[model samples]
Target: MTGDVWAVGDAYEVYVGRWSRRVAPLFVGWLGVGAGRRWLDAGCGTGALTSAILAAGPADVVGVDPSRGFLRSALDTARVAGDAAALPLRDGVFDAVVSGLALNFVPDPARAVAEFARVAAPGAVVAAYVWDYAGGMQMMRHFWDVAADPEHDESRRFPICQEGPLREAWAAAGLTEVATRSIEIPTVFASFDDYWTPFLGGQGAAPAYLATLSDDRRRRIREDLRARLPAGEGGEIALTARAWAVRGHKTAG
Candidate 1:
């Protein structure tokens, strides 16, 4: 989250790529969580997932994130946004809670979990998903393959993307009946440009490296990435990607 090349709002749409889209639909289906009375989506980013929850049948689906720029874009996209740790909503205000591909990015995932538990009605469900980076996240593997040097390995910062540790995180948050699943989703790119161009713009991880690349070196990097992919006769790279999802129901008394 440091560095000048980073841009998250609309400037960073691809930051949430086909993978997020591919994963969102699954999070909704596996959640099997009805619309309920109300739903809260924490770390909702630009609110795509929030909108999906609403469409699934919830009378209300509120999206909360800490970034104003992101929220502004989220509102433009027709979803409400607020803080993740201190949601602006009232107490016991939701029937079920959800989050898609968000927890791993949070600095204090535990506090965020406590906040979801606090806002949900007793017996309501709180469910969320994170990319299993160590075990199944593939796009990062692309970057890591190209970027792993003696001084840096960006993937290491993401410990929660692994399943067992993520489950422990839920337990530590006091959520019970915790269950986890490994869901596979496809991440397909149209072309080499479609795959590698997004990175040169310096959006997320790619940008970090892009900023360090000189013009000739950047072009060389692009060529290198292209060579790794299958040639254009309907070339497809199957992202053996996954979403490590976990859910727990609040105790009913």
Candidate 2:
């Protein structure tokens, strides 16, 4: 998930957005957002987390992403096409700021966290969640483990997605009460093809990496994943995805 493809913002609703629903409530719940408060969903891809915030009864919500197409899809709230490191809104206006599955993709997560702290009022909450790329993000782990293709590296893409780095980014940004937890969600596939077909769409890192391979190589990779995945009697494969989530509050003035 580079800055380039994320700029397009199409089909991700079905690919990333669909799967991210599993952890949306968990992240928003950890946020503990209440009603009648303004919220900012930074890097709110396709309104997944934004929708969750709305459901939790926030008075207003604003979603910002670099992708215009994603902003278009995120029709439930105020939308802005912009970068996370630099939001074009006034400072100290929001009651809470949150992002989901986004920090790892941002050009500068530390800067983004500082920005989240910047736009938040004193004592307002700042929270975000990212997939555990090195560990329990099963789909990605499986793909990277089996693919072994040097054309792309997931670690380079998600340097701050783990527990330690996530907490460090928040603390370095001067946020207080910095705390983190792991949120696990189910990733159920109707069949192996249900899970395998999306990788051909060329949206995320796996798909993008697969795009660079020859047709035969891609087919082989697919077959290898099919073999490695454990299927149930009904041909369904159930996997758990774990995302590391962090939350903190801006210091009171």
Best by TM-score: 2
Once fitted onto the true fold, the runs of candidate 1 whose alpha carbons sit more than 4 angstroms away are 1-8, 75-82, 150-154
True-vs-predicted CA distance for residue 8, candidate 1, Å: 4.1
- Estimate TM-scores for all models: 0.85, 0.95
- Across 32-127, the per-residue lDDT of candidate 1 in tens digits comes to 776456778887777767666656674566777766666776644335556566677776777788887777666677777888888888888888
Model 1: residue 230 alpha-carbon error in angstroms = 3.8
Candidate 2 Cα RMSD after full superposition onto the native fold (Å): 1.7
